[model samples]
Target: MHAAEGLITGLCALACVTPARAGNAVQAMPVDAFLDTLAVNTHVNYTDGAYANVRNVGDDLAWLGIRYVRDASPGSGAAPLSSYVYLAQRGVKFNFLMHENITQSIEEVTRLNTAVPGSVAAVEGFNEINNWPVSYHGLTGIAAGLAAQREVYTRIHDTQGFAGVPVYDLTGFEPKQVESRVNSADYANQHVYPQNGEQPTYEANGDTWMGNAINGLKKYQLPLVITEFGYFSSPQAGWYMLGVDEPTQAKGVLNGYMDAAAAGVKRTYVYELLDEKPDPQNKNDGMHYGLFRNDNSPKLVAYAIRNLTTILNTSTVQRTRVAATGALTYTLSGMPVSANSLLLRKKDGRFVLVLWNETRIWDRAKGTPLSSPPAEVEVDFGTTASRVDLYDPNVSEAPIASHRDVRKISVSVPDHPLLLEVTPGAPPRL
Candidate 1:
């Protein structure tokens, strides 16, 4: 059942799980599962009261292999220690920040980690350092701001013995700031607003939101977290990028993660779980980006996240072509896929061979890449062949596709499309 169906039955959520497919350019998994398999950390928004929700689902989520939690200034008197304890009891593991209140941030993180005895993870100095009004450095500039942050980060690490704790130094996409964030702290916590606070407009082709993260953070190779992401509706209703609706935001999350994965970013956390108040710009906003409504009922995006997590958390590897030989021959490696709504592509002259796998049933999903078992593959016989197959070593099944002797096979490409030709016993003539 699709995740939206759960909303109708009062199950609190619907889950979207896309099965693993073979030979595709893009792949996806759920946020939780994606983080877990990668052994990366995840954060839940404080606004959603997700502390309890995360606790409730902690065990199931643990299967996804998540280890740390960013409490977004929780222990600094914004919320209660019981909130931190709730997460600890669930086997979730650590904390991302205490509060920028410095002293409180340090004290609380220390207290929580000590009490939980290894559960309290790390503490961030504050939220986005480069963006936000409070972080404004004025004429001091990004370098000066980073230097200041380094001072703060160093002091926190040294004097406080907050030393062992992983300090999540965060910043905006500003190039200078990103450089500083990477240089200043242990983990590079980034906030990406791919849609630029606009509603998402879906097209027949893949959504643009998928490429934002790749373009935004491609330069850095540090351990990173997309701490916040959501569809921000513009103030003017008529000017909204996507009409104020659930489908648009749901699609945004999918496309956003797909883009992140395609860019090879392995970890991401959605902006918020709950939308308690309306955004200042648009009264109808905020609530729309949440996985759950203010009342705690799951939205379509929530289910999508859950099911995608199930797939990503499992023992499956999703990949993209960092370098391709051509439309048909290439070297592929795993990419960070957190959900199934990914578009995989290969540039082939005038046409981009792209695959759109909205539904992740690899075999059923169009554009599945067929594998040629190492033993059966030959570089001798030639008969212009376009073949797609999935070789299940475990099942000893012939390629999953029905085509036997490959000339050309009609296989659907979905969001992950591959364009290639394979001829047994055929060798390239240079």
Candidate 2:
């Protein structure tokens, strides 16, 4: 990967032992909310290499339970005329990247929305503008980008087809500076790739709040969109950021999603769905950034994500109105400094407590998993459960551990995400 393309997520890690903070209150969000925030980047429009060889993107996406992908507009000419129509027809939504020609972008999505209504997930401005600066009509650099951004916002919002669509702001610029300028968009955009294959919470610097604050993207008062972020599990490629193994990639990406959500990002699209080039020798840094290999083979990260989505998928309709419900409180103890938790409620009223430790687990220099004793975390909802289940995506779809009629459960965390299901028993009716 290029130096300019790296993502600095600002997730920090502490080496020494420090007690994880106890929650003052447990805030619960719908599981589907986090699932919807998870998205992947794709070069489906590019007709070359693995992208050219693989034709079952829709199938792969369905298997992963991922409904959205990031792609280039048809008019960009890097793609043939209407190349992504088939994928759109398969109920796949796309966040289209706008090329130089804004008119072509409008026309392309118009055609798409006409064929497949609501096919457009979002419209992104120029990517990594710091590296690939835009020169627009005598205007150059940030000035041109700002002009084009305002134009895109105006055109997208004014048009009937795109009136309801959200326009994400451009990346690779001073977000703090842009807030006062003409940064026109509904959502603030960011691209954060954690440094040195670090844990998603592992901050390169002393500041642990970087992932949440994230170069001041959170301060914009607009919903943050992580357009591009992921790890390339290639050790052969010599770069400043040391690449990790495939297992570490899986854990890091999953941990990254949880971290991003906890940080309040509206959406996160991991970079590139498939490795475009097949570097058998593991030489190319960019080639291995995919969840799938060039041959469309599944990586550990892909399976874990699949498992996660499958466990979260429910057949029940979404609750339109949130009923009067009690807030469930749970005591978390013995959590390491890197341990984190998120509470999610299923439509059926089951609570899913996600526990993961973001402590460093990959020895980048040795290219091996850093071995350490599993840290145990105990959680007690203070109410007996009628149904208790647990799932570790890296293991299998089925619950790897389970308990019933118990209010407390102890689990081990080794840089892995564990989902615990608790259907708290109802209070005794008078």
Candidate 3:
């Protein structure tokens, strides 16, 4: 079977680890210390149209994913396009996914480099070569796909304008096919959609679909970019394949980001910013996967993403054990659950502890939704905290609560993640 087909058929059956005894156990996973790693996908064609929305979220985003099209001028003549300039002004970088013919791609790259040098950080070949529609690159099979990608890579590398820029190979849905096509490109790329008719979690066991894809690319020893990864939410089912509710979509987005960061991927761009249409009729309509609705209003997932980027984009993250004098406990949907926490120390000396219930609850096929059972978790920082603030992703308000000069804090950990901002001191030194 084709690798993409194999993944679709096999990943759902992959055994998941049975829930561990419901209780608090110190998670030993080391925190990833990379800032400016969050990126979101946007269309070059939509850059001008979606300027306002882009401006709203652009500040938090590190990179913008766009398609490189021939005859498409991001900006007129010697000046960089307004969108490019806007992103640049906000300290955001952009990467192009080459979709047009190689000749045009080369010319576009030359024009881009000449017009706005250093604006385009990386260029990727065709996208999702193993999936339908996107897979149709006028190439018949895998062999043809490889040859076409090689030509694109060679031409991009040989272009004088793209001298210092990194050219990425075509990002494919199938790992083996993508791996086989890899040549001397500066970096590697892949598109991982782990949704299996449910809300997916970051399984540390590396058995989940996303985990398998990450593992597959590790062999290349190249910096990886997950150009597209997201979940679709629809009020009515059957329109989208992995139909999820707003809350489920929100959880999936945050979980996907955390998973990719934890796996040490160089960068990850959520599939899209806005919906293509108002309401999608089927999986092929392309209207439901956006972080925002077609009406330009922010969806639940959008706020969650914004909150995650705001809190987790720290310069350094240190994993410290929470020392509590008394036992702290929590439960999810009546079942005892352990909360996962990460201590992130920002560049400004502000410390934030991201806490979330580690339990996986949604399964679309089974009609299950993300469980939001609440629990009170008491944690004592190794040192005395001058001030504490709670930031919940699900809520649209300034820190949910604030406290002063507390050595220990009792936080109500919900199924969704929460950020506890503490004054810069009192944690065990990493």
Candidate 4:
């Protein structure tokens, strides 16, 4: 894990710890571990774009507590993407995409490591090769793509500077294309986009789109990586563009994070950290992918993420030897079909039960977020005898409500997530 972690860690969750509640765990993962799974795409090389337009790139990212970034490029030798250098010195890690120029990318990674040791999280191969077909020395289609991946994978492993770094493979291909590729990756990689302002794990062709994408890449038999997946926050319409209202974007983002983790995706990188350019007319899909606007002001998703990281963080509090933790035995009632529940364990021996309703709240026709009745989720944690604190990252990091001396609690689950933090008794008084 990086000095400051992200939110993309997979089910390495409990680290093989025996479950005290057996299989009663909902989404059993450590908070710090799950925070390691989250990352965002960036454009530090777009010197004239939205990323460069605002001078507070690091400030914004630090504000949101993001520790990793995936970029198509990391600027050439001349500029060297120096803007993010300061943050890299602190803790940020990069997963540089090598689809454009593998040799140049290798050099850049080597140079970056010299400046900042242990800054490379991963090195990736051809991106969306279907759209940008690879043609190496007359090789075309999947052949060239595979060959390039092989070269990069081998080179990265052979290069002493970053040999230990994992290599992610190409995406954007048919299932046939995926099947053609073999032995070229440590992780099977793919991209997913929930269309038409839908839920992050939106339904598609009788199944969740994410599930379908994961299945399509299952031939790799390797841990999966969602290299790109996000919704643009522009209030525009048309199912193809994937633009939704900001509120919907925020809700989908949180839902998508949990959905990806729940699906066992090794990591999920949201499309971007900042809009690439200004789209005052709300017309450009690429311009609105950022968690922050072109002017560097954060969107709703940004604030929501900030609150989330703050709530889940254990570094801010005193470090103590936490008790052995297992799954929380609990029952949730009145959860709607759209509702979802995720239970996360913290290294500090706390449990955060995240509850959300994925109801369609964005009316694209009206270009606004529609209000839905809150689901009164009655939660009964088996034999609860301590305090339970509730927090809504959409609102604030501080607990919005708390309960004491109660075995059951009721939470008004809205479209977004509400975390119920339960404090277990002091190990039954020794």
Which of the numbered candidates is closest to the native, going by highest TM-score? Answer: 2
Report lDDT (Cα) of residue 1, candidate 3: 5
* Candidate 3 C-alpha error for residue 204, in Å: 12
Residue 362 accuracy (lDDT) in model 1: 14
Candidate with maximal lDDT: 2
Candidate achieving higher lDDT, 1 or 3: 3
Over the stretch 241-297, how does candidate 2's per-residue lDDT look in tens digits? Answer: 667788888988888788777667788888768888778887777888888888888
Tens digits of lDDT, candidate 4, 329-366: 77787876567777788776678888877667566566
The residue-level lDDT of candidate 4 at 265 comes to: 82
Clashes in each model (backbone N, CA, C under 3 Å)?
41, 8, 1, 8
Superior candidate under TM-score, 2 versus 4: 2
Poorest stretch of ten by lDDT in candidate 4: 1-10
What lDDT does the true structure give each of the candidates? 0.41, 0.74, 0.56, 0.72
Model 2 earns a TM-score of 0.90
Encode model 1's per-residue lDDT on 191-277: one tens digit a residue: 544322231112223333333333344456565555555553222233212223454455456555544454445455554545544
| Runs with alpha carbons beyond 4 Å of true place in candidate 2 | 1-6, 9-25, 181-183, 203-215, 236-239, 314-326
Point out the higher-scoring one by lDDT: 2 or 3: 2
lDDT of 4 at 218: 71
